[model samples]
Target: MLVVGGITRLTQSGLSIVEWAPLMGVVPPVGEAQWQEAFDAYKRYPEYQQLRPTMTLAEYRFIYYWEYAHRLLARAIGVVFLVPFLAFLARGYLRGPLLRRLLLLFGLGALQGLMGWLMVASGLVDRPSVAHERLAAHLLLAFTIFAVCLWTAADLWPTPAPDEGARRRLRRLHAGLVTFGALLVLQVTYGAFVAGLDAGRAFNTWPLMAGGWWPPAAWRLDPPLRNLLDNIATVQWIHRTVPLLLLLVAALLVAGAWRPAARAGGPHRAWSVALLAGVLVQATLGILTLVTFVPLWLAALHQAVALLLFGVWLAWLHVATRARLAV
Candidate 1:
C-alpha cells in the first residue's frame, strides 16, 4: 500500500479520483460509461485543465488506476488489520497498556486515511500538487504508524539479555541510537519536502548544486528562513546532508556497541550492524534517485528503503531500550 502511494505520487496520479468514497470506492469503473464518468469528473479539476489538458481517456485511466489501487490497497490493509485486532481484543489477548497502545495505533491509522484525502484535496484546489507541508505530514504520519507498530511488536516479543560487562558501552550506544532515530525522522521529513517541491529535479549533479558547493538560490528566498523549508535547493541540500550525518553517527553507534570481552555478543551490536546496512542502502538509493532525476522505479525503491531504514532503527532502539531496562 505504501509503495502504491509512492507510485501514485511519482506518476502525479493522486488527484485523479478527487472524491473520497470509503466503502463505495472499492468497486472500480465497470464499463466505458462509468470510466468516462470517472474521467470526466477528473477533467473538471485543475490537474486536467492546467497541467494535463491534452490527456486522453486512455492516459487518464493510467493515472486513475494508480490512485485507485492505492486507495483500494489501503482499505484492504485496514480490513486485514482490523479483523485480527478485534479478534485479539475479544480474546483478551491484549492487556492494559498494550490494549491502549493498540487503540492508539488504530486511531492513527484512521487519521492517516483522513490525512490522505486532505493531501489529495490540497492539489484539487488552487494548485496542481499537494502542499509541501501537508505532504510531509501525510508521509510522516504513515511512517509514524509503521514505527509504532514495530515498537508494539518489539515490546511484546522476547529479546536476548543485556551483557553486564558491556552495559556501559551499550548505554552509550543506546543514546546514540536515540539521537540517530530523531535525526532520521527529521531527514525523512525534509525528504518529503523535497519531493513535494520537485526539488530533486533542480540540480541533478552530486558533490555540488548548480556548479557550486552551495547553490546560491538555496538561500535566495525572501525572509531567509523560509528557504530552508520552501526553497528547492535548500530542501535538497538538507536531504543530501542528513544522510551523511546519519552515516557518521551510525559509525559512532557501532563503535560504542562493540565489546571484545563480552564475546557472547548483544542486541545492540547486532541491531547496530543492521542499522548501518540500512543506512548505506538508503544513502546509495538517494543518490541514484537524485542523479537519475527521480525515475519511477528508483524513486519507489528509495521510498521503500527509507521506511525499511526507519523500521531497522526502531528495532535497534527497541532492543537497546530493553537492554537498558534489563541492566
Candidate 2:
C-alpha cells in the first residue's frame, strides 16, 4: 500500500479523482457515461487545465485508475484489519493496554483517510498539484500510522529478555533511535518539497547540483530563508545531505549495540543489525533514485524502504524503552 501510494504521488496521479465520496467513490465507473462524467470532473481541475493540458482521455484514465485503486486498497486494508481486530477483541485476545492501543491504531487509520483526501483537495482548487507541506503531512501521517501498527503488533508478541546493565545502554540507544527517526521524517518531508518543486529534474547529477558543489543561485531567493523551502536546488541539497547524517547515526547505533559493556544479545542484536541493514538499503535506494532521476519504480521502492526502516527503528525504541523503565 505504501509503495502504491508513493507511486501515485511520484507520478502526479493523485487528485485525478477530483472528489472525495468515500463510499460512493469505492465503486468505480460501471458504464461509459459514468466514466465520461468522472473524466469531465477531472478536466475541471487545475492539474488538467494548466499542467496536463495535453493529456488524452486514455492517459487521464490511466492516472484516474491509479489513484482510485490506491483509495480502494486503503479501504480494503481497513476492512481486512478491523474485521479480524474486532473478532480478536470479542474472543478476548487483546487485554488492557493492548486493547486501548489497537483502538488508537484504528482511530489513526481513519484519520489518515481524511488526511489523504485533504491532500488531494489541496490541488483541485488553484494549484496544479498538492501543496508540498500538505503532501508531507499526509505521507508522514501514513508512515506514523504504519510504524505504530508494527510497534503495537511487536509488543503483543514475545521478545528476548534484556540483561540488567544492557537495559541502561539500551535506553540510550532508544533515545538515539527516536532522534534519528525524527530526522528521517524531516528528511522525507523535505523530499516532498523537492518533488513539488520538480527539483529532482534539475540536478539529475549526484555529488553536486547543476555541476556546482553548491548552487549559489539557490541562496539568492527572496528573504534568503525562502530558498530553504521553495528553491529546488536547496531542497535537493538538504534531501541528499540529511540521509548521510542518518547513515552516520545508524552506524553509531550498530557500534553501540555491539559494545562489550552493553551485553546486548538476542532481540537487541537483531534490532541493531536490522537498523544497520535497513539504513544501508534506504541510503543506497535514495542514491539510486536520485541518480536515475527518480524513476517511478525506484522512487516507489525508495519510499517503501524508508517506511520499513522507520518501522524497525520504532520497534527497537519501543522495546528498549520498556526494558529501561522496568529496570
Candidate 3:
C-alpha cells in the first residue's frame, strides 16, 4: 500500500477518484458510460483543471487505477485482518491484552483509511497536490501501524531464558537504537515532504546543495520554523543529512553490538548486522535516486527500501529491548 500510494502520488493519481466510497467504490467503472461518468466527476476537481485539462478518458483511467489499487489493497488488508480477528475472538483464542492489541490495530487501520481520504481531499480544493504534512502523516501512520504489529507480536513471543550475559548492561545500545529509530521516523517524514514538494529534483548534487552546505535551504518562509517544513532546499538537506547521522549511529551500534552478538551470551548478532546492511542499501539507493533525478523505478525502490530499513530497525529493537520486556 505504501509503494502504491507513492506511485499514486508520483503519477498524480490520488485525485483521480474524487469521491470516497468504501463499498460502492469496490467496483470500478466497467462500461464506457461508467468510465465517462467517472472522468466527468474527476474533471470537476482542481487537479484535472489545473494539471491535466486535456486528459483523455483512457489517461484518466491509468491514474485512476493506481489510486484504486491502493485503496483496494487497504480494503483487502482490513477484511483480511477482520475475518481472522473475529473468528479468533469468537473462538476465545484472542483475549485480554492480545485482544486489546488487535482492537487497537483495527482502530488504527480505520484511522489510516480516513487519513488517506483526508490526504486526497487536501489536493482537491484549489491546489493540484496534497499538503506535504498530511502526506507525511499518512505515511508515518502506516509505518506506526506496522511497528505496532511488530511490537505486539514480540510481546506474544516467549522471551528467551536469560544467561550470564544478560548481566552485562545493554542500556547504551538500547538507547542508541531508540535514538536511531526516532531519527529514522523524522527522516521518513522529511522524505514525504521531499516527495510532496519535488525537492529532490532541485539540489541534484549530494553532500552539497546547489554548491555549498551553508545555505542548507534556499528560501526562508515567513516564520523561521516554517522553512523546515515548507522550504524545499531545507527539506532535502535534512533528508540528506539524517541518513549520514543514521549511518554514523548505525556504525556505532554495529560496533557496540558486535562482540555481544558474537559471544554466546551477547544479544542476537544478526539483527545489528542486518540493520547496518539495510542502512547501507537504503543510503546507496537514496544517493542513486537523487543523482538520477528520482526516476520512477528508483524512487519506488527507494521508498520500498525505506520501509524495509524501518522494519529491520523494528526487529532489532524487539531483540535489543527484550530484557526490559522480560521485566
Candidate 2 runs further than 4 Å off: 88-95
Expressed as tens digits, the lDDT of each residue in 121-208 for candidate 3 is: 9998989889999999999999999999989987878877655454355667778889999999999999999999989898888767
Residue 239 of model 3 has an lDDT of 92
Model 1 TM-score on a 0 to 1 scale: 0.95
lDDT of each: 0.87, 0.83, 0.87
Reference-based lDDT, residue 310, model 2: 80
Model 2 is weakest, by summed lDDT over 10 consecutive residues, at: 159-168
Give each model's clash number. Answer: 0, 0, 0
- Candidate 3: segments with Cα more than 4 A from true spot: 164-168, 216-219, 259-267
- Candidate numbers, best lDDT first, in rank order: 1, 3, 2
| lDDT tens per residue, model 2, 1-327 | 888888888878998898888888888887888888888899898998998888887888898888988999999999998999989988989889888888888998899998888888889889898878787788888887887788777777875555677566777687778878888888889877877777777777778777888876878788999988888878888998888888888888888788877776667778888988888898788778888878988888888788778878888888787787667
